[model samples]
Target chain A: MKHAVSHIIPNLTTLTASQTLFDMVPLFREIYAFRDLLWILVGKNIKIRYKRSALGFLWTFLNPVFMIIIYSIFLKILLSFDARDPLFLQRLVTGILVWQFLAMCVGDSLHAVLGNASLVKKTSFPRIILPLSTVLANFVNFAITLPILVVFLFVNGTTLGDMWLLPLVIASQFALCLGVSLILSCMNVFFRDTEHLMSAVMLAWFFLSPIIYPFSKIPEAFQRLALLNPMCGIVTAYRTAFLGTDLMAPRLVVISLLMSWLILALGVSLFQRWQVNFGDKL
Target chain B: MTTPAPIIDVRNVSKRFSLQQQRGETTIKAIVVDALRGHGKRRDFWALRDVNVAVQQGETVGIIGSNGAGKSTLLSLISQTSQPTSGTITTRGKVSSLLELGAGFHPDLTGRENVFLYGAIMGLSHRQMAERFDQIVAFAELAEWIDEPVKHYSSGMYVRLAFSVAVEVDPDILIIDEVLAVGDASFQRKCIARIDAFKQAGKTLLVVSHDLNTVHTISDQLILMEKGQIIATGDPDAVVAQYQWLSRETACTAETKEWGTGAVKIKAARFLDAEGQEAEELQRGMPVRIEIGYEASRRIDAPVFGFSIQTTSGILVYGNNTQIEEFDLPFIEGKGTITLDFSALELLAGAYLFSFSVHSQDHQTNYHRLDNGHPITVRSERRYEGVCHMPVRWSVGKGK
Candidate 1:
């Protein structure tokens, strides 16, 4: 009797034996449907940052200011180069602010999925929100600190021109940080060593970028290879917008933009492939 | 007109997990070497295999099984917390699962903030959650601590708040896995009543529970699973009977060794009905007779014959001895039968093990003892929510 009844119930829900490349699109659409969840998580991340702090949101501005003072003292006063040039201070502040944003985003993203193992195991939502929210939280921090950059630029007597282009540069940097964050976060879920590796890599990437030192300081021979680092083009564009430096090389900006999109595609694809196994792995 | 589809249609679903034996394999060097060699040892085990279940709208289906029976795996698959390795699960409604209470709660966040955060995680908008926020807090009875961080709330308060938010979302299908086992008894009763109301409002419910009575009472249909397979699926009483019989058989087979000094011995033990006919299963809240046959090789003074009814987990539900009951047995030399009769066995629907023993007056020396001697399967006529059913009456009226 049981066998007869079992046979009568048709298998209406059938899963494919294997996944195809086209499956990526539907997975993205699923994540898109849960965008509101991403925003809530981002809000949670930002709220927790200042939850118990005494200075609260002021720390966001104070952090960049402190880093600028320390770097300027060490690089300009001790090293005794360009101590009076306002452009040097303007360049350093803008570069540090952007670099701090990327560092925090990457550092936090490394633990995004691993840190939320409880939620991943018990709840059903878009898993990508875990990493995306971490990136966005850092983005909110960067926005909070932007006023400090404006104050520094104003104090240095620097004026902005064609400021509309600034959003493009910021957008490219956002995409770049988000892409790298996605890859690191997803990989960290499997290989916990990825987080430590990222800290070291971010340190090296920071010094290699023109954050503390001017891009022109690097000998012209290594300039092309330096531009290969997406942050190089992004920081150069920020300097061009604020300090009125020469425009970034068109080829370098294009290369950075292409790299951002490519990394995003790669990160997303890798994330989707490993996500089905995340619940069990965690 | 076309027939409406079931709220959840799970077809031939199976989930397999690969167990990594080598801790070294997690390291980069080991993984690199294994990849280069193109060979890695993988041991995979299936938690569920080809399990088929369809939950129509307004149906409450309970899944009951022993530990490691893939009950949670089935629930996880249905809830979409985890995907099956094979087959497909099609859910046609907003499915909310309370797989674990306070699963996504942030300890640092206040209860009010967590409500919005959890609501958003469950796909409710900030505006929608704001509208339901008061209702959720009121239902949880946690208005006093709603602004305090969840870390300060007791475990019971945490569960109450989490359960309130989950149920208040008004999901079309609700999948719960043993979350009601927490909280105080009154709160549990309230949660169960809320679930009952959900059923009345035509919501599909898939519940997994080790509490046999709760499942038997709540589920319109029951699915009995064993070792990743659905062994039986039908009426709650009949399925529970099958589960009890199987559990008893397995328990008895594992403990076959018996030891005694043989001054006095329990020869046989069996359950009997009112007509004195041998019966392996009895209806709950009905008369039950456990007849124990014994013999004595030599004369013994004041021998105490007793029996205990225990769930398979060895929880002593009820037990009684002739000596404790003050039924003085003077002496015994030869074959005799000890009869224990209960007017109504108040056991809920489940399997129970019967252990019969004979001991001397001081209860220090055991003449003979049979552990897990027999199994009694009880089929309850009415739904209950605990280990044993208590006879009671209910009245409802407005207090003037």
Candidate 2:
């Protein structure tokens, strides 16, 4: 009977691809199984990122801090933009911190596979770990910049109204970054054009996000469209929850969170499917 | 112990590839025209065709073939790197292939970091890789450089680390294709020892190599392929003998050489055994006779009758002339025949080139020559090996 059954299955030669969602369980288990590899890969990228550089980890903090200062000057002095509430610059800095995380994740994640094409073509590990590791490494960079967000709050003499929700917001943004990065990284393998196209798109995405300007500055007609940008909701929520800004819309946050989860699940499945056959194409 | 079922069964598997050759398509116009007319299209190439083999658990098999003979393609199919274009190959147990070392290495990552990354890629868990990490570094002999980025490693060091990581993973079914040719001799010896140990532990191995000695040492069975088809398969010694015979019989015809005509013309040539029976099969350490017939348009004196036998790498194994034998023979006019009788051919199993030549004895200049004469196949008849199987005496340790 065993011999008979073995002859019946076609393509059984290929480790028999999983047809059901439960199949993802083993894949996830496999990813978890290689957690040290995941952590070490993330750690290695972090180490090599600053290796041989003078500023080292200080550069991580300087990037967002410098951007916040530049944008603060541009908005307060050049554009003469100020909220009647008197905490305008603090709110803008909050948005920039979140935006920096989003930008870095998008920027590095697109080349996650191409940059390590050697690893992609040679090893049979879960390919998602690559983009996941990039996101994880970027998280470390984001963590160093978080202190600045708190400094902005302290300087503004703001109260932490619902600041306890900051971790949840950060987690949501991470999920959203991973979901989008996964899709882009997979696509990057087939179309190298995605790498260049991504940078241009992200620049436009930044302006559309409420990072540089205030949400109140936008016409209400376009407010809904602005909220649709995933990072806009996260950044706005961070400003509201932490610095006591009133820009948060719970409805938009919920929508983006749900969309993030949906994209994450879909992206994971697509990346897994494409990964199994990558050795052939790569 | 109960006999194991054939854990690896490959049946009637074929892999076909589509090769595209486009001409004069600088602009979009050519592509549009070709797409419209459906002409000047891609061609189908069969890298492996209708191959069938089964290995019981704990078997060691060697796959030998010339370049583009589809050796790598066959191993790739078995390893599932690429799906077979047709038929089936079913294997049970974890499959690991070392098609090329350092294939997935990240240059920017340190050796230690690459170990984990490479481990995960090869499907090993963190704990598993961690447990073996020290041993891997020790085996690769890169202890001091483990923390340095892999980009800084020399070519030999890279292969050493890559190979160490691969072998340490311990998958059930291992497929290797020409990956052992790197590193120094000591490392190669260490690798061969590890493979032997793996076999002793009852692992299944499929090895593809041009190093016939290593293949012969490690493999219990063999398969020979040519032009995408399986030509022979069986016990290691028998299959190798047959492959060498096939290689030689077709040496003139085997597609290994492209024939050309210059001045003197080779009429007919064939290989024969000592009994004068025309045969392609030559036994190692046995006399091999090569006979050739050639027609010269003009008279030639003291012609340096020579033949050169070469390997696929174009490495000359041996070349000599009849003048060295001190025989003075005169070539009259039209046609003549020459026969070379050897006391014994000591070459291990390999394809060798044979050619007939008539050079100016005084000047040693090429007059009229057939560089690749009729092909002569030589193979090992004895179980002993090395570049040449030398006659030796041995003494075994005493037993009570």
Candidate 3:
């Protein structure tokens, strides 16, 4: 019976099945083949974010500026600090803008896979592109807001010191955000509670990163502990770029770069390990 | 002469899903409870088991089954949207599947933008998509509205654009799952014509549908699946015949149901072919004989006997009575048999319910009636649109 049926059918393709976990080579190849799709997803995300709003892309600029004004007003009344000082204001605004990029990227990444459940179930592509596009969309927003930082520097009568270092800092920050996004997006696919858990984690992460206060405010004994937070080096580097200050030491930059790369490695491996379960689980 | 190789080969493939008792339990409390339960609350479900299939180039294969028969699971496996738990599936060339319409479409994006986006998802380069953009829009017949957001398009228009892009991607093997049922009748005709052209171009096609007529018309071979196994595979008519029999046997057993005075009870009814052997299945345009065994408790004068054939959906396809034909039986008593024969059954490919009854000569009272009589299946090699064939032909001539 089987032979009769087999004769009626034809054979033009061949496949072999095996369980392959932690196989990075094929994963990379698949992602590379789907690179165009990654870009299109990123474009869709960014377009949909600002498509309907009246202010549109203006929100990317107004968001950081409004946060700076609010924080400065509250601090001026409560702390009796010199909020009028141009140097202090410049550092504050630049730090918040950079921190906004990181927070928004990680925050959106948490829901990346869950939000595209329909697409995930219908088509097969590199699962990492969903989270990766979230990060890239926020990066485009950050790029759009960079001119605001430049305007702030000029208004404050400050010069960009070691301007070439800005690209390196942005690249490091992008890697760090991409890494965290990859891990959190995969976790959120399996666990609905991850969305709530992430908000609390980001709240704590914001305070630990020294975005509001300068790095020098920490006591010498606690400076080493604060440096362990990767964002410490990142925020400080932004401040150094704007104010031409010597706060971002060489050792701190190295630590942050190494930490970002390590996290990225871990995130990619974990993403590949969990991606096979996505279609079944989702 | 050497035989050419098949385009798709699947062997002994099976898929198992681990279903959790409590879905999406990611809280700390749930995790702790699950760990303590030692994974005992989870169950394994095998959607497919040791199924194998192969299709050569240019062959259009149709898969048919009722719901939950593992049709979708098998398609997903072949399309590589999901991996099987065991065995191997290998295919040559690119595989594009329209598992669902507008699956990757963003509602806020314009139809034009979604064309590029969907193309990329299907593994087309930006330049390649741009070159085919006009052709895709034209095929969908949405040239004027291509720039409008897809959310504004009607559901039919949305599906048209999605289907257009899927077929335009130039895939070597196309897998479609119940997507041809979308769009208006005219558009459906156009889509069928396009697919026919695609088949002529020597691309392998795999389709899963519940519409038996569509399957019968398009497929070179048919596969009938039940409970995660291919029960029958071969000629479309034969497989459909098997499917009809299996479904009828499972759903309605004990086909004989009678309610009358028991004066003239129909003991049994059987359908036979030309050779006179009992046959429940017969082909279209073939002769059929229905033998009715009856036992009468009392003699009846001028008894009228007849039969009615209704499609499975209860639409009466054919009916005849002795009184209607001006023929009468003198009497019927004790055990006896009557036979009705059709020189050639013009019924289409479907299952039909046969009912036999004996009434008064004046056609007022039914002495005995068998409402749920024998169910017979008719298989056809040619496609017929409606319930029964009307026996028509066409000729072309110049109009003046």
Candidate 4:
């Protein structure tokens, strides 16, 4: 026997298993309601990454500085890459920082969902928050270290050209990282081989993107194909904004922005599919 | 029909978990292998059947069954972690499962920090958790250790703090699996009291426990399942009773039937269902037997062996002895099992105690007596609210 229920049905909190996603409205709302959870996870990432170390939070600033020093020596001194160029160290610093932010997000995401298997298997929070938190954590770290970049720029005496375009490019790179992170994180959940494969992929991807080398160095015929990487456009835009290198055409940056969001949309849909059985996979 | 919309409505939902997925095998190898094999060869194990249940806004639904009965799977489905392979589950408001107690907890974080982080995972904003922070700390009784990292806390302390943080989130719909069974006895009692208050406040609840008595006493409706299929779901008493009987037929899992003393000490006792097979439970209005095993130290004269079924509260439902039944008992010795058969037991659906005794016929001496205090579960299909089900019919004649 059932009673004639008189309760009103409010919108937005209803969930149907048949289609948990694809309709982004409620997904966005769920994510919004759990924004506090997202922030906490991001905080956890930032804190736990350097826990138990003597130079804990200092590592965030020191890490990039050291990488810049090591790679500059390995590249310009050892490999003699554009050794005569006076501003080569500045270029390397700016390029490495941009690359490191993206790398942290996508790289961390490989373990984002897998490492938190307990969370994924037990609770039903917005799962995107996992990969998204990695992206945000790296973003926050990057934001906190902007002063380091600014300090470097001032020390080098280089004028930041079309400085406003910097935020747009940074935002573009965040989207690219988030999209790829989602894909890699979900893939890693079902296939541990993705971890090995992702490391290899990220290694190759580092070279594929123009972090140390200028984008113009790529053969002229391949430049059009390289723009499709999204990161190429991003890295180029960042160097152009900071070092005042020939600013990559506005149209190319626009193409990368569109590509970034498109990949993000693809990531969301694929994540929905992969995540359906995440508890089992994890 | 004005059917009041239940806050949680699960309709014909089923979930199939892939074996390959559990083994961490992914698409790339499977894709290439499947192409070479000329077909899809992956296997899926169905974890749930067509389970359909609806719970009104304030109803408490208790799920009980043996291991691998898909109880947790159903909870996960309703809680929104794992999606169903087929069918739809719709729930209103936030559904937080205690199954994920302390989920996302970092061992390096202090107990206080873990609380907010754990709270945040359950949908509590930092400000909201901060508002309840002091209360949570006091409830966990971990004030001294709150600032210490969770890794330093004992496992019991970890669970205590986690349970405290979860209770404070106070979602509209709560899912708990063996949560009340956690912590020490005193902590468990505290959790039960808190859960009772939550039930009193009219929150929709789905609770799962192997402890049948607790679930039976607390739930309005009970679900019994076997092999991912619902065997029964209805009034708590009747469903619980049926689960006992069904479990007897399915598995040999029964309580080592509890307290008694005497010369004719009831070494052990068992109940037989209508089919005359040993079971942990008996069906109401069905023929059953209570078999008592005893080992007498020496020969006893004119000993009266008897049994009494009483309400758990000590009210007598029925009692019978060999002398009362006009059977004269001779001297008894050695180990043996004696059975008392009932054509049909009419007790209502509730736990009742069985008291077995053997004494001198004149009541002058006691040879042996065993009141194991093991409550026998009598299941019923009808919802008769009392200690016994009376055979009565209503007639609407003029004389009536």
Candidate 5:
């Protein structure tokens, strides 16, 4: 009976692919089975990215410092925003540091799946591992940049309030970025237009979120609509935890937490469903 | 005893590729094409069609096919790199596939770094890679350059490292494409020995190679594919014979053919360079040598060895003989060599077929004649055009 059935179907290649697309249990299991690959890819990404530079991974922290100085000069001198505003630097630093993880992951993973099409064409493993590792590597960089926020908090004379909730905020943002990265990267393999359109969309997303601008400045109606962008709630959460700012529409945090995971699940499902044909396309 | 469920089972597998969208089209260009063509033409390309096969454990199956016959596609399906458009392929045990040269290696990373990275990509644990790291470096003979970036390594070195990693990982089923031909003779021999060990073990192996002799000897079972379908299967010798017959029926192209009498025999002939390195390719204006190794079964009097260079279209470019050059050997016995040396090969950038023959100085008795139409490519950097390069100097001042 086993011999007859083996002729009918075959081994793990067909067995794993036989599962329904919605049955993500196999995917998660494969991910767990290939966890070492994820870590190594993450390590590889980091080393290849930074090894050529003289400073070597120090740029993770140094990046935010450079941005902070440029933004300070742009806002205070060029825009003539009052330097007397204490909370301004705190808001800027929190927003930029948190936002960097999302930008970097989306950018890197944009090419992660497509750039490694040669590997994809030859080898078979969980395709999700590519984007997952990219996001995790950027998260490591995000962790490294957090100290810059600590220095900024001191400079602003802001005592950390509700600081423990920062982990939840980080988790929410990670899910959102991973989801977006996965979608963009997967689509980039097929359409390639996704990569070009993504840059424009990200620019719009950055301004829509209250990174440099304060949330209170927006009109009430626009503020409610802006909350639909998960980064709005995410950036606000960072400011709330660090600078003791009011969490406008307190459910925004919960929305962020829920919406990000929703997108992440959607991204994972679509990617797996479509990846069966990825090798053919590549 | 039951045959352990046939380790690999591929059933009625067919892969279809759509022709609507050209592959590797840039997004902007794709969008433009979409707007311009607007689904003007639609056709589906069948890369594989109703291919089926089953193999027991410890079996070595060699797949032979002309280009684009879907041999690579079938291997991809078995390795689970791509799913078939229809049908199912089941492969048991750990399947390690070496599909192409320089598989997924980061060109910027050092050889040491890429080894670890590639191990992980092949789903090997860090500990496994670490354990075999030394052996991989040693087997590839790249210990001296392991720390150097792989981009700097030659193609031969790159293939050596990749082959070492795949073999050392001890996979249950090994699938190799045509990467084996890249390494030098000794490295190739070392790899063949390791592969022989794999065969000695109970592991399954699938090899795809254009070198019919290697495949015939290495594989006990052979699969011959044509036009995305299996045309022949079973014993390697029979299948290879069928493949040869079929190709002969289809293509009446002549290759190296030699006819000789019983006196003298030409054993081997090869092209060499000034440094005595065996030459695969040559550059214009480089010193070249054509050495013919011959054996006289019995004493032969006044045998003349001749060499000819011809264009692929059968146009003879140069022909010379020992008798014509007035270089004579009274008699030759046992084994000896006839060397044709060129201070500078003046042929331009193109391919040429070589011919070697031996006969009596009187041209009455033909001991051997060989028309070797195997094309050898000649390269040149200078922009001199035509079938031959001539040294020239230019003085452009008219008043002078």
Candidate 6:
């Protein structure tokens, strides 16, 4: 009788399990494997962006600062808005900060696929990580701007009652931005016109999200429309968390969470659909 | 050793590529409209179709083909870089494909980092990579440059590091596709030695190479592919012989018009050995015979037959015939044959060509000449150096 040889070495395919969550093993494995590459990719983008800029990291701080000044002059003073209203400027700045984070996330991610086309064509890896890493790097910018936001609030003589909620609000804002960035970056692969379309979309999204004007200023029917937009609830949550309870709406928070998950599911599925064909088309 | 079951069983695999030359917005829209109308506006090319192959454990198989014959495409399918459109590929080992040098390498990262990065992509554990880290660098000969960014390295350095990491990661099945050609000759020798070591250790290897020497040196089996299908597969020597015959015939037909005259066309030619038999195999320094058959348009006088032997790289190794030596024979125009016998085929182990030309004995141009002539298959029983195999013997003794 001929004896069969047992396989001592496992195949890459065998290691991949049938369960969906098991796929995360390779994702996490690859993350750990290419950690150095990830760090270098993020580091290089940051260094090249601010390399010779006179202000360096202060430029990160200056973006929101400039926006706050412009908003104060045009929306607060020139327009004769009520500054004395509880956390009025704070509420406005919360919206602006979220908008700034959104701006950085979407703007950087729009070029993620185009910028790394060489890597995509030559090497095989999870290409989603390229755009996701861009989002993670921009998160550093958001984290850096937090102290500035805190100092401004302190100078305005505001007191914190439920400060722990700020992290939750920021986390939700991140989820929202990530969901949108994922969708846009994948779309940019098929349609080269998506980058330009993103600029126009961001411009339109800015006005629709109550960044320049409060949600309350809009008509009742329009407010319902605004509430339907996930950014509306996230921005409102940020305002309520920082402003110490002027308009804390938990119902919209629940709605926003659901909306974020929906966007994430849609974004992930869309990305996965194109990923199998990416190596060929790219 | 043949295993009970092949570790990789590829069945009826085929990949069709519909490549669009233009991808601008307007072009894409036009294609979409055309697709909607049940028409494909893109040019379709079959990269591979109905290719069946199986690789058993501890077997080293070499895939040989001409350019665009889908050798790399087959490797890609096995490595899962791309999927086949029409077949199933079931593999049972941990496959690590060195598809391109430094394939997953980040230019901005240091070599140390890129190693770990590529390791993770290959599904190696971090600790496993860390354990092999020093060995990888030592093999790559980049101890000093390991901390430096890979972007600063030369192309050879890049391939060395990449190949080192790939081999060090302890893969069960390895797929190498022409990456050895990227390095210098010395590095190529080193890579070949590494591959030999891997085979010695009982690893399965699938190699695609245009270098027939390497294929002959290392491959236990050879797969000959043509036009996206496997034309032959079996013993390395036999498959190589088939590949040579096909290549020679193809080369002969391609330049047929330039070499043969319409007046008296040389239809085919064959080479034979001393026993007066059609020879498919010949040893170095052995007598061989050449037979040329022609269909004539008109009768000619004092016609002489000439043949030249050439190395595969197109260097004329030896040429002389009755025409050049002033020997002549009469030929009728309708149909005839000629035979010439050489005492010994003084050639090395490689494919050699024998082309024939017919001319008048007086050195004037003749009515019929076949310059592409016929190709003779040559193989030396003993591996010899240089263009022609010189007869020699050696003895091991103290220097006298």
TM accuracy, model 2: 0.84
TM-score against native, each model: 0.85, 0.84, 0.83, 0.77, 0.76, 0.80
Off by over 4 Å in 4: A1-12, A69-83, A246-257, B1-3, B25-41, B100-108, B148-155, B249-400
- Residues A1-282 of candidate 6: C-alpha lDDT, one tens digit per residue: 001111222243411112232254665655655555566566656755686689877788788778777876786677666545655667778778878888988888777766765456545456667767787788888888877787778876777546777877777777777778778888877676788877888898888887756777768777666676888777767666666644646775668656866786677667755655555565
> Cα lDDT of all candidates, in order?
0.79, 0.73, 0.80, 0.77, 0.79, 0.72
In model 3, state the lDDT of residue A146. Answer: 88
In CAPRI terms, where does candidate 4 land?
A: acceptable
Query: Which lDDT tens digits does candidate 2 get at residues A1-282?
Result: 334222222213343333322266766765775566688778876876789999887788787778777876897778775655466777777777788777787888877877876765554456678899999999999888887777756765777657777888888888888888888877776556677788789888888877767667768898777666666668777877876676556786777556666777777777766665445555
Residue pairs clashing, model 1? none
Over 4 Å off, model 1: A1-32, A83-87, A159-164, A246-248, B1-3, B21-25, B29-40, B249-302, B311-349, B367-369, B378-400
Q: Mind giving the per-residue lDDT tens digits that candidate 5 earns over A51-166?
A: 77999888887888898788778876787656566577668778888878899988998888877776688777788899998999998998877877788667657788778879
Rank ordering of all candidates by TM-score, starting from the highest? 1, 2, 3, 6, 4, 5
Pairs clashing in candidate 6?
A11-B93, A11-B94, B298-B333
Which ten-residue region of model 4 chain A has the weakest summed lDDT?
Answer: A1-10
Best by TM-score: 1
Model 3, C-alpha of A110: deviation from truth (Å): 2.5
DockQ for candidate 6, please give it: 0.29
Ranking by DockQ: 4, 3, 6, 1, 2, 5
**Candidate 1 i-RMS (Å)?**
7.2
- Model 6 scores a C-alpha lDDT of 0.72
Q: Model 3 clash pairs?
A: A11-B5, A11-B6, A11-B7, A12-B6, A12-B7, A13-B7, A13-B8, A14-B90, A15-B89, A15-B90
Q: TM-score of predicted model 4?
A: 0.77
The residue ranges of model 5 lying beyond 4 angstroms of the native Cα positions read A1-11, A15-22, A73-84, B26-40, B249-400
Candidate 6 CAPRI classification by DockQ: acceptable
Considering just chain B, what TM-score does every model have? 0.80, 0.80, 0.76, 0.66, 0.63, 0.75
Q: Give the docking tier of candidate 3.
A: acceptable
Error of 1 at A37 (Å): 2.4
Q: Tell me the tens digit of each residue's lDDT in model 4 across B192-277.
A: 78878988988888999887777887899999888898889998867876676555433333222433335667677788887778
Fraction of true inter-chain Cα contacts (below 8 Å) kept per model?
0.35, 0.28, 0.48, 0.59, 0.45, 0.23
Q: Write candidate 2's Cα lDDT for B138-254 as tens digits.
A: 999999999998899998899888878777876677888787888899999999998989999999999998777789779998988899998888887887766666656443332
Q: What does the lDDT read for residue A140 in candidate 4?
A: 86
